[model samples]
Each structure stands twice: as C-alpha cells, then as structure tokens.
Target: MRIALGVSYLGTAYQGWQSQPGGKTVQDRLERALATFADVPTIATLCAGRTDAGVHGLNQVVHFDAPVERAMNSWVRGTNRYLPDDIAVQWALPVPATFHARNSARSRRYAYVLLESPVRPSVETGRVGWVFRPLALEPMQRAAHHLLGEHDFTSFRAAQCQALSPVKHLHRIDIGRRGPYWRFDFEANAFLHHMIRNIMGCLIAVGQGLRPPDWVAAVRDARNREIAAPTFAPDGLYFLGPVYDADLGLPRHTPAFDWLPL
Candidate 1:
C-alpha cells in the first residue's frame, strides 16, 4: 500500500532534507524510524522539495510504500515514537499508487526573513533570520518586482546547481514590512539552487542603498554571478509548503499560512 505523510521539522539540527553519508539528515532519521517500526528492510520515501542545511520547513510532504496494513494513526504515532523531537509526523493517509511527492507538486512557496535591530534576536527567532542594519522596506519591495516573471536566474543561481537550465517562471514575488523587519514571499513552479536567498541578498543591498533599484534588472540581463549580491544565510529560509492537486488525495490547504506574518 502507498501512504502519504505530512511532516514538520526544525532544520537547525540536521544537515539537510536529503540523506548524506556520515552526516545527520532528516531523511536518515525518518528512514531508520520507519524501518524499525514497519520491520521492512527497504522503504523508499519521496519529499516535495529539498531544503538546504539550516533551512526549515513547516509543511513538508513525503510518500512511501509499504506492505503493512496499519491504520493512518498508527503510522503517525509509530514514526514519532522513534523520531527525534525536532522532526514530527503531523498526519498520514493512504494514497493512490500513482501519487508522487515531488513530480505531482504544482507549486512551492518560500519566505525569507530579515530582522532590523542593533541587538541580536532572542533565542526563539535566532535561527530564523539575520539581524542586520535597518533596511528600507519600500525600496526592497520595488526591487523584488523585477523578479516576478519568467526569466533566466543565472545570476541568482549557485555555481554548484545541477539544474539543466537556469530558466524558470516566478509566479509571484512580494515584499512586506512589519515593524522594523522585512518579509519576502515567493511562489514558483520550481526554484534553482540558492535562488531565493541570493535574490533576498541582492534586495537587501538595494534596501541598504548599496545598490540601486535597477541593479536587479542589470544583473539579470548580465547573467553573471560575480555582478550579483551574495547569497543570504540559510537560517532565514523556510520551505513554506508545496501545492498539490486535491484529486491526488493530498491535503487541500498547506500549513504555510499558519506561520505567515500577520
């Protein structure tokens, strides 16, 4: 039988979402817990997206197939029993054999956080974002406008990105302010490696008056990473969630909105 699981994790402790040799990872813990509980030698799990180290996820989806006929609640409780406190299984349900966690995802949403304060943030949000000089929110919003449509994000992509093409369609990009902090929201069908953090870093430069609003457009046209701003820290990034078709038996509403800045 095929089962789909909804998961949430604080990524501060793990290397990343994928399994790595000799490195602690979310996948490694999940696989071990599932194997021990299900008594299966091999279990294949698929995630909606891959988040870099120190990045977090509020609603991550994973699917795997097993021969056990246990109830959904059993899967959740059983998995959580052996998993660490940082990783929790929120829900589990039977899914069609054809369902896929990654391929069937229609879109992904992410948020980058920035805190403007002379002092560092408290321990609660310390791992969530950068606490830097006050940034001009209006200029940052205006600069983000340049990235709304489809374009080659070569300037924002990591040099190590293995994606076949740099071209991607950015469905939405919006910047909003709350108090002294700034929030950047983005939605796209797919993202290139380090794309969101790199974009945020460039916008931060613009907000700080180090770069003009037109700098983003110029960098995009130049298609050169050297001319673009540096990539922001991964701590501020969160894999908001993935949008999947309802007909595929996935949850209709993602958990992303719960963490949205009011």
Candidate 2:
C-alpha cells in the first residue's frame, strides 16, 4: 500500500532532508524509525521538497509504500515514538499508488521572516527571524511585485542547483510588516535551489537602499548569478505548506492560513 505522511521538523540539528554519507539527516532518522515500525531493514521515502540546513518545515509531505499491516494511526504514533522531539509525524493516510509527495504537488509556498528592530530576538533566534536595521517595507513590497509571474530565475538560483531549467511560474510574492518584524510570502509551482533565500536577499537590499527597484527585473533578464545578492540565512525560512489538487483527496489547503496581500 502507498501512504502519504505529513511531517514537521526543526532543521537546525540535522544536515538537511536527504541522507548523507556520514552526517545525520531527517531522512536517515525517519528511515530508521520507519524500519522499526515496518520490521524491515530498508525503507525508501520521497519528500515534497529538499530544505537546506537550519531551514524548517511546518507541513512537509513524504510518500512511501509499505505493507497494509501497519495502520495509519499506528504509523504516526509508532514513528513519533522512535523519532526525536524535533521531528514529528503530524498525520498519515493511505494514498493512491500513483500519488507522489513531490511530483504530484500543485504548488509550494514559503515564508521568509525578518525582525526589523535594533534588539535581537531572544525567543526565536533560530526559529523566527532577525534583522537589526530599519527596513522600508513599501519599497520591498514594490520590488516583490516585479517577481509575480513566470520568469527564468537563474540569477536567484545557486550555481550548484541541479534543476534542469531556471524557468518557473511564480504565482505570488508578498511583503508585509507586523510591529518589529517583516514577512515575505511566496507561492509557486516549484522552486530552484536557494531561490527564495536569494530573492529575499535582493529584496532586503532594495529595502535597505542598497539596490534599485529595477534591479530585480534586470537580474532576471540577465540570468546571471554573479549580479544577484547573497542568499539569506536559512533560519528565517519555512516550508509553509504545499497545495494539492482536489482529486488527491488531501485537504485542498492548510487550515492555519492567512492570505497575504499581493
């Protein structure tokens, strides 16, 4: 039987989502725990997206095929029992054999946070966001508007990105401010490696008067990585959620939702 698992994890302690040669990873731990529950030595899993080190996921999806003997509820409880506190299995359900956590996803959303106060955040140092300088939210919002559509995001992608092409349809890009923090929300069909972080860095530069608003479009047209800003820290980023089509039987949207202004 095929099963789809919804997972949430604190990526601060692990290397990344994929298993590494000698490093601990969320996948390695998850495979080990799943083995214990399945009573098997090998279990392969696929994720909706690969999050870098120190990044977090509020609702990451993974799919795997295992025997029907393992109940959905038992899989959740059993997996949690063996996994560390930082990672938890939120829910598990039987899925169609054709369902996939990655390929089947319709859209992916991500949020990048920034604290715009002089004092650093103590509570969410590595969890929330942190920025010590005053940021002009209006300009940042304006700059983000230029990115809301299909474009080749080569400038915002890492040089080592393995994606076959830089073309992607960016559905939306939003910027908002709440008291001492600024938030950036993005939705797209898919993302390239370090795409969001690099975009955020460019927008921050625009916010700080370090870059012109037109620079965003210029970079896209150039399709050159050398002209783009540095990638932002992974700590302030989150895999907010993924969107699936109604036919998938999964919820169409995440319940804890807030629609950011476009």
Candidate 3:
C-alpha cells in the first residue's frame, strides 16, 4: 500500500532532510525507524520539501510504499517509537500510487521568525533569527511587493541550487510584527535554494534603513547573485508544508503549527 505521512521535526539537531553518507540527516533517521517498525531492511521515503540544518518543519509531508500491512495509526505510533524526540510522524493515511509528496503539491509555504533586539536570543537560540538593530515593518513590506508575481529569482538563488529554472511564481508575502517578534510569511509555487534567506537579508537591510525599499527592485532586475544581500541564517526558517487538492483528503495543519509564535 502507498501510505502518506505528516511529519514534524526540530531540525537543529539533524543535517537536513535529505539522506547523507554520515546518516545524520532526518531522512536517514526516518528510514531507519521505518525499517525497524516494518521488519524490513529499509523503506525509502520522499518528502514534500527539504529543509537545511537549523530549520524546522511544522507539517512536512512524505509518502512511501509499505512493505507490510499495518493500521495507519500504528504507522504513526510505531515509527515514532524508534525516532528521536525531536522528530515524529504526526498522521498517516493511504494514498493513490500517483500521489507524490513533492510533485503533486500545488504550492508551498514558509515563515521566517525574527527577534529584533540589541541582545542576542538565548532561550530561542537556533529557533529564531536575531537582529541587533530595530526594524521597521513598512519598509520590509514595501520591499516585498517587488517580489510578487513570476520573475527570475537568480539574484537570490544559491550557486549550488539544482533547480532547473531561475523563474518562480511568488504568490504572496505577508509581513507582520508583535512586540519584538517579526514574522514574514511566503507562499509560492516553488522557491529556489536560499531564495528566501537571500531575500530576508535584503529586507532586513531595508528594515534597518541600510537600503531603500526601491533598492530591492534593482537587485531583482539585476539577476546577479553578487548584487543581492548575503543569505541570512537558516535558524528561523520553517517549512510550513505543501498544499494539495481538497479531494486528496489530506490534513492541512498539525498541532505543531499552533505551537509557533504568531
């Protein structure tokens, strides 16, 4: 049977979502747990999105073909038993063979949480990004407007990015703040590697009055990675997961979603 799973994890301890030779990645740990639970040598799984080290996932979706029969709830509870405390399987259900965790996704969402203060973060270290200077929301919001719609995002794309194209359709970018916390939400058909982090670096520059809001347009138009701001730290980035058609009967949110600070 083809089974789909909703997974969540604190990425601070792992080497990212993809499996690596060191076996310290989230994929390695998850596949090991699956093998142990199903009494198989291994069960390869594919995720809806891959996050870098220090990033987090509120509802990362994955799917695999089960090697044996088991209740859906058992898949969740049993597999999690072998996993580390920071990673877990939230929910599971049967899906059509045609359903792909990555390809079938209509769009994806991400959020960056930043703490604006002179003092660096302590308790929230590795979970939130920090800015030493005060940031104005209006300038960042105005700078974000230039990123809306389809455009070549090569300026923000990492040199190692393997995406086939530099163009992506950015659906929306919403910036909001409460107290000293700033949240930037991005929805897009897809994102280039390091795209959001690079953009964040520029927005933060604009927010701190280091660059004017209109400067973002020039960077986008330039399409040269050298001209854009440097990539920001990945600590505050969260993969909010993928959106699928309603007919697929997938769960949109998990308890972890509520745990994030608004």
> Which candidate should be chosen as best, given TM-score against the real structure?
3
TM-score of 3: 0.99
| Tens digits of per-residue lDDT for model 1, 22-91 | 6498888888888888988856699988888888877788999976778899999998998999888888
User: Between the candidate structures 1 and 2, which one is better when assessed by lDDT?
Assistant: 2
Q: lDDT scores for all predictions? A: 0.83, 0.84, 0.94
My TM-score estimates for the predictions, one after another, are 0.94, 0.94, 0.99
lDDT of 3 by residue, 1-262 (tens): 9999999999999888999999999989999999999999989999998888778998999999999999999999999999999999999999999999999999999999999999999999998999999998898999999999999999999999999999999999999888898999999999989999999999999999999999999999999999999899999999999999999999989997887778
Please, what are the lDDT tens digits per residue for candidate 2 over residues 28-76? Answer: 8888888887888878999998888888877888999985477789999
| Model 1: lowest-lDDT 10 consecutive positions | 252-261
Ranking by lDDT: 3, 2, 1
Indicate the residue-level lDDT of 122 in model 2: 84
Global local distance difference test of model 3: 0.94
The 10-residue segment with the lowest total lDDT in model 2: 253-262
In candidate 3 the C-alpha lDDT for residue 184 amounts to 93
